[model samples]
Target: MKKQIRFILTSVSILLSMFCGLENSYSLEENVKIEECSDLNCVRSHIDEINKGIVLLLAKRMQYVVQAGEIKLKNNIVTAYDKKRAELVVNNAEEFAKEKGLPSGFTKEIFQVIVDKSRDFEQIKMDKKSNLDKIKTKK
Candidate 1:
C-alpha cells in the first residue's frame, strides 16, 4: 500500500512538472487498484511497469531534445554534442546511483549510453531539417 501510494505520488509529481504549462491537470485513474507486491512474480511485474514508465519519460525527453535542436538551428548554431552538459548529466547520475546503493561504474556506463543516444537523436533532427532546407534551395 505504501509503495503504491509512493508510486502514485511520484508519478503525479513527474506529470505535474512536465505538463504544468498545459491547461488540464493530469492524475492517476481513481478506479484502478494498486496491488501489493507479496511475491517474486508480483515484484517483477511492478518492476516491468516501472521500466515502461522510465522509457516513456525518455521518449518525452527525446522530443524536447529534438525541439531544442530546431531552436539551435534557427539560431545558426550546430547541435551535435554538448560535452559540458553530458558530463554534468553523467556526474549527477553517478551521484544519484551512489545514494541508491548502485555501483557508480554501472550507472555511469548506462548514462553514457543515454548521452550518446541523445546526441544521435538531436543530430538526426538537425540533419533532417538541414536536408529539407537544401532541397528547398535546389528547387
Candidate 2:
C-alpha cells in the first residue's frame, strides 16, 4: 500500500508538470500588452483608425480571393490553388505583424478570422453558381 501510494503521487506529479508545460505553450504572455495611454480618448481614436485600415486590407484580400475563385471556376482549377494562396496570406501577415511590432498571436488570430471569412465567401459563391446552373438546366 505504501509503494502504491508513492507511485500514484509520482504519476500525478508528472501529469501536473506536463499539463503546466502545455498551458505555458499556449499562453499569450509575450504577445499582448496592456498599457495606460496618456491621452485615453485620442489613443483610442488612433487605435480605431488603425483597426479600420487593417479591416480595409482584409476586405481587399477577400476581394482578391473571390476573384480567384471565379477564375478557378472558369478555368477548371481546384481549391488547392486557393488554399495555397490563403497560406501565403497568413504567412505574409505574420511577417508583417512581427515587423510592425504587433503581437504575432493577435495578428495570426486576425488572419485566421480573415481566412475563415474568405472560405465562407467562396462557399457562398460556389453555391450560387451551382444554383444558377440548376436554373439554367431547368430552363
Candidate 3:
C-alpha cells in the first residue's frame, strides 16, 4: 500500500534527522593550527601551562553552572537560561585563548566538547533532583 510505504519512509527520515542532529553537535574538524615557534622547549612548556589553565578554568565554570542549575530549580527558572550560561563558558574559553596568543578557533572547538559534557552533567543532576523531589512529594 502507498500509505504503508509513506509511513516507512517518514520513519526513516525522522531517524536520520535525529542522527544528524547528534552528529552536528560535535566538532568535525580533525586538525587545528597552533602558532609556530622556533623554540621547541618554550612552545612545549607554554602549551603545558595553557592546557592546565584551560582544565582549571573549565572545572571552575562547570562548578558555577551546577550551582546555577540548583538555584534555578529552587526558583523555577527556565531551561534556556542554563543553556545560555553554557554558551558563556565556551565564549570565555575562546577569549582566554586569544589573550594567551593561542588560536581561538582551536580553543573554541575544545571548549565545545567541554560545554557538551557540562550540559550532560547538568541534565543528570536535574533529573536526579526532580526524581528526589517527586519522592518527597509522594511521602
Instruction: Give candidate 3 regions above 4 Å deviation.
Output: 1-60, 78-81
Superposing every Cα of model 3 onto the true structure, what RMSD results? 15.1
Model 2, stretches more than 4 Å misplaced? 1-38, 78-81
| Worst 10-residue lDDT window, candidate 2 | 19-28
Q: What is the TM-score of each candidate against the true structure?
A: 0.69, 0.59, 0.53
Ranking by lDDT: 1, 3, 2
- lDDT against the true structure, per candidate, is 0.67, 0.58, 0.58
| Candidate 3: tens digits of C-alpha lDDT, residues 1-139 | 3453344344333332333234332211223333445675855564455546545775697787788778878887635235576688779977965654444476576566656766777767777887899899999
Pick the lDDT winner. 1
Model 1 regions lying over 4 Å from their true place: 1-36
Q: Score residue 124 of candidate 2 by CA lDDT.
A: 79
What's the CA error at residue 138 for candidate 3, in Å? 0.9
The candidate, 1 or 2, that scores higher on lDDT is 1
- Give every collision pair in model 3: none
Ranking by TM-score: 1, 2, 3
